[model samples]
Target: MTELALLVQGLLDGSIYALIAVGLTLVYGLLRILHVAHAALFTLGGYVGVVVTNETGSFILALVAAMIVAGIAGMIIYRLVYQPILHLPPYVALIASIGLFIAMQEGFRFYDEQGVSYVNPPVQGTLELAGQTLQLAKIVTFFVAIILIGGLGLLAAKTRTGVAWRATVTMPAMAESFGINIIQVRYINFFIGSALAAVAGVMVSLTTNLVEPTSGDVWSYKALAIIVLGGLGSMRGTLIACFALGVLEAFATTTCVPLGNIQICLGEIMNRDAIAFAFLVIVLMIRPQGLFVRA
Candidate 1:
């Protein structure tokens, strides 16, 4: 791929990461929990999308259903699992989240050990742009992510709900005293976050045409690295980190380096995940508080 093509591909990849990481950042910012079960929710969305699309042959309907179901599940998790344990140490909630993730994965495996795939994907074929061929599903995924992320930005910046969310994050006691419903804000946070994850999951399934029981495993780790690298709980930082990682990974995997007389691609040397985490480690060594966190 040409330089411009690689750049575009990286940005497109970043859009997906942004969708996944944004949810983690939001939940962490508000509740100070890692929410590892989010990955399971993502996988759940993919399975739901696959089933709905196969049954109804409507991709739009699948997306909507996945978002609604995942959003509701998120709210329930918050109310039932996290609420009672909020006063405990943060690690306690994190452990519970990990357990929930494992249990959900097992449940999915029990449901379909072989995983699932979309029988009638809504988008097909590819588009050539800037000397690169891009999948139509990926293009759709990019646009959907942009719309959702942009809408999230608008919600955070322009609405009364945004004000309440910010207040709750900064000063929950004061927010409640001032008539803001902290519980509602928390619920909204999880709903929006989980919904975004579901959309991402559906998009991934569409792009790949497959949804495995463990589809979200790799993403869960990458999302954790992204939120932490971006500065835990910092949405803007998370967005920046997502794109940065994407572009870096793109170049790392595709660009060839001259070693002696032979051209060696980094992809041949280290996989994309290793490249991402190596970058994270390098960045953290320099900026221990994270790329965007204030000292």
Candidate 2:
């Protein structure tokens, strides 16, 4: 029962990671930029959502507003910072993003100088699954992730913007020859990715019921690891890796192994972040392309 509960919790956590990683992977696929500042967008979402919830006492409103704000911010960043460097070397953009990340982190620190922040879920209760109880907030988050991902997947497949994005990434010259506006595609993709990250921020805050200014920095690194482990540009790989890592972290944190009449607490030996990177190293060595990437 304990193992089952741990697995469930791990998968739920993984879902959030997957949500965050999807955005990171998508942006990478579109522009090949690391977009380190993406983390700040996540933190911004949480801060905005918390403030909105506090002022209006409406979780749904807060969620929508946060996403909109973050999405717009993402577009603005791309236009002001990335667009100017679009033709420059990738490393140049990477450096710019790093600077942007630090600036946004400090901005959050200045604004949210209060103590820790948290958001309350709109509904309460738990669902029993396979004799294990699941928090309503987690369930909502899981469903929301599935719905958003699915919708995005469909949009990518069917919409003109989606088709243009794929074509532009596949062959920028050919896409441009066909009159596809790569700039517009980039803007749309960045907006979608950033908005998704915002949703992840809000969901994560609801699940943990806590938020700090550093939350973005923490999850941003983990999200980067997730995308790398899942394969840089493969959405399917990212999802698979995200849950696998999540479950692995859960097991590490919760499962105690017996060894010759003694118990070993894996979680104590290495924290979740450490466990994630350990898996990352092994995966990189064994399968440099990632768990889901096939060469």
Candidate 3:
């Protein structure tokens, strides 16, 4: 029963990671930018949702507004900072992204003054399944991850814009020759990515009941590691890696192992936060291209 509970919680946590990591994956694939500020956009969305919900007393409205604002902010950032350097070396854009990330973080700190705190969603409770309990907010967040991830997958696979996006990523010149507006596709991709991040941010706030300005600082690195572990540009890999890391961390936390004469705790030895990178190192050592990517 205890094991079951851990597994359940892990899956729920993984869903949020997927929601966040998938967006980072999309931006990397489409624009070839590191998007270091992606998680800052996520933290911004959480703050936005908190503010909107406080003002309106409506979680749904807050969710919608956060997504829209984050999406628009993504577009604006691209226009102002990324577009000019789009054709430059990837490293150049990466440095610019780091700068943008810092600016956004500081802006959030300045805007909130005392700093933003958590606002619980209207719904509150837990679900009991076969003797195990699950938080309602987490369940809702998991479902949202599923629906949005599925919807995004369908959009990328079936829609005309989706096709154009694939083409642009693979061969921008050829895609442009085929009449696909690369600039528009770039904007749309960033919008979708940032919007996804917004949803993830709100979910995190609801589940954890805290929204620090630095909330995204840790996640930004984790999401980046997730995409790399899942395979940089492969949405499939990102989703799998999210859950994989989540479950691994859960087990690491709950399970104890013996080493020589001493019992060593995985969580204590590696630390929960470092587990992602530990898995990353192991995966890279085994498959340098990532779990899903082919050489």
Candidate 4:
């Protein structure tokens, strides 16, 4: 029962990780740039959600507002920041992204240095599932991730927009030559990716019940690690790697081993974030191309 509970918890956490990392994967796949500022957008979403919820007492509205705000911010960032520097070396864009992330963090701090908490979370209480207690919000988060990610998959596989996106990714020049609006595609990519990140942000803030200026700091790097470990820009690989990391971290934190008269607790030895990076290192050593990248 304990093991089962851990597994369930791990899967729930993995869903959240997928929500956060999928946007990063999409942006990287389409733009070939590490959008460190994507973290800022995540933080921005949380703030928007909190403020909107508090002011209007509507969680659904908060979600919608966050998505709209973040989506527009993403398109603006792409046009004003990334588009101008994309002709330069990739590192240049990376540095700029890092700078933008830091600036946004500072901006958040300036807006409210102390951070904020939800006035009234929409979901409260726990649920009994398979003899294990679980937060209702987490369960909701899991289903929400499923629906959104699955919807994204369908969009990519079935929609004309998806076809255009794939064409742009495969051959931007040819896509443009064929009358596909490359600029529109890029804007749509950023908008969707940023919107997804925003939704993830709202879900996370709701679960935690707090929104801090530095909430996005950890994810900025961690999401990068997830994407790289999953094979950079591989959507399927990213999903697999997110779940794998979530389960590994869950086990590391919850399980202890007896060794030579001394019990070793993995969580005590290393923090959760450290465990994630360590796993990434071990995986890279074994398969440097990443878990799913074709050799």
Candidate 5:
């Protein structure tokens, strides 16, 4: 039962990672832009959510509002900033995103108060599941993620907007020829993707109960790794890659092996769960098209 308990915890952590990764892949697949600013955007959502929750004490409303604001912000960025660079070289656009990321990072100093220690919110209730204790937040997050994934999958597979979005990925010019508003679709994609990131950010906040500007950067990198590992533009592939990364990170965290009577740290192999990113680099080197690219 103890072993089962640990396994449950690991799966819960992986699910959160998977949610964040899906958002990252959405931005990459739909916009074809490596949004370095996404890290800042993620943190922004969490901060906003925290503020609203504090004032009104409505967690669900705070979550939704955070997503809406972040989504609007993303759309604004796309229309005002990225639109101008759409025709530029990929590397040029990449550089612009880096600039935005840096600016947002520095901008957080405006919110820094003197001597306010970060205190994590205490929603720490445990549930007994089959004689094993598990965190309620983690379990709720996992189910929410599963439902969202299933709904998004259906949206992509069954709806007109989803089809349009997929068509754009397949061939932007052809999608435009079919009379779809390319710019509008881009805005929607950006909005949804960024909103997803915000949702993930809020979920993460529940885990630590603290909000910090730098937190977004950490989540973004994790998402980036999952997006790359999942094979661009394939939602199922992205989910698969997320779980794969999650399991790897979890294993590294929960276990350590003896090497020649020395207890070598598994984290040294993958610190803070960043081994997944290293694996992504190797995968790209070996298969630039991605290991799970949709055929």
Candidate 6:
């Protein structure tokens, strides 16, 4: 049962991180923004979604409205800030995104320290699976993350914007020459990627039963690690990295170490992500392009 519990918890946490990674990678691939604002946007999603859900008493509607609002926020950022940076050095855009991230964090800090409050779990029941009992909310979070990934996969494969987005990612000038309306496609990527970030925020709030402004900052790095370890712009590789990180996190926690010689407090940094970063460092040192690179 302990082993199974570790498995379930690991997957749930990893799936949540992967969702954030997809949104992060999408924006990075399309706009080359290196979005520092993603953490802010993710936290905003949680806060706003919580407010809407508490007010309207409708789970589904809260998600829809929150994502739409967040997408608008993304559009504004793109039009006002990022679009102008096209002619500038890449580092300029990077700096702007980081500034945006800090601004969002401070903005949220001004609003609430208790932060965007969350609702109690709607489905409080537990299900026994694989010889372990788990909360329905956790299970839902796992599946919902997968569904979002699946939906995005379909969009990438089937939609006109997806094709244009891909072309823009690979060769923006060439895509422009082909009449792809690169600007419009950039906006589309911005909106869709932002919406996915919001979805991740909502999933996290649901899973943890709390929302805070600082939450997004912690999550953004994990998503970045996923991108680094998964091979840049490889969606499939990113998802695989997510699960592998999740599993590694779970096993590490469960595998006990002799604390007598350990200098640091294990409890302070016991979660899967810390270990995942160490693994990432090791892997990158070894392979560099991640585990799933092509010839």
Collision count of model 6: 0
- TM-score of predicted model 4? 0.96
The TM-score between candidate 5 and the true structure equals 0.89
lDDT of 3 by residue, 1-295 (tens): 6878888888988998998898888888877788899989899888888888888888899999999999999999889998998778899999999988988888887887555554545657889976888889889999999999999889879999889988888888999999999999989988999999999888778866667778888777988988999879887888899998888888887688888999988877777888778888988999998899821
Model 1 Cα displacement at 123 (Å)?
0.8
lDDT per prediction?
0.91, 0.85, 0.86, 0.89, 0.76, 0.80
Highest lDDT among the candidates is held by which one? 1
Q: TM-score, each model?
A: 0.96, 0.92, 0.94, 0.96, 0.89, 0.89
Which 10-residue window in model 3 sums to the lowest lDDT? Answer: 113-122
lDDT by residue (tens digit), candidate 4, 47-108: 99999999999999999999999999999999999999888999999999999999999999
Output the lDDT of residue 180, model 3: 95
lDDT at residue 227 of model 6 (Cα atoms): 78
Candidate 1 worst ten-residue window by lDDT: 286-295
CA lDDT for candidate 2: 0.85
lDDT of 2 by residue, 1-295 (tens): 5778878888898888877888888888878888889998888888788788888998899999999999999999999998899889999999999999998888876776652454444556789987888888887888899999999999889998889888887788899999998888888888888898999888777756666777887788988998899888888888998899889998887778999999998888998898889999988999888887622
Show how many residue pairs clash in every candidate, following the order shown: 0, 0, 0, 0, 1, 0
Clashes of 3: 0
Error of 1 at 195 (Å): 0.4
What's the lDDT for residue 34 in model 5? 79
Which sections of candidate 5 miss by over 4 Å? 1-3, 113-123, 128-133, 260-263, 268-270
Q: List per-candidate RMSD values in Å.
A: 1.5, 2.1, 1.8, 1.4, 2.7, 2.9
Q: 2 or 5, which is superior by TM-score?
A: 2
Model 3 whole-model lDDT (C-alpha atoms): 0.86
Ranking 2 against 4 by lDDT, winner:
4
- For candidate 1, what is the lDDT? 0.91
Q: Would you list the clashing residue pairs of candidate 5?
A: 120-209
Clashing pairs in 3: none
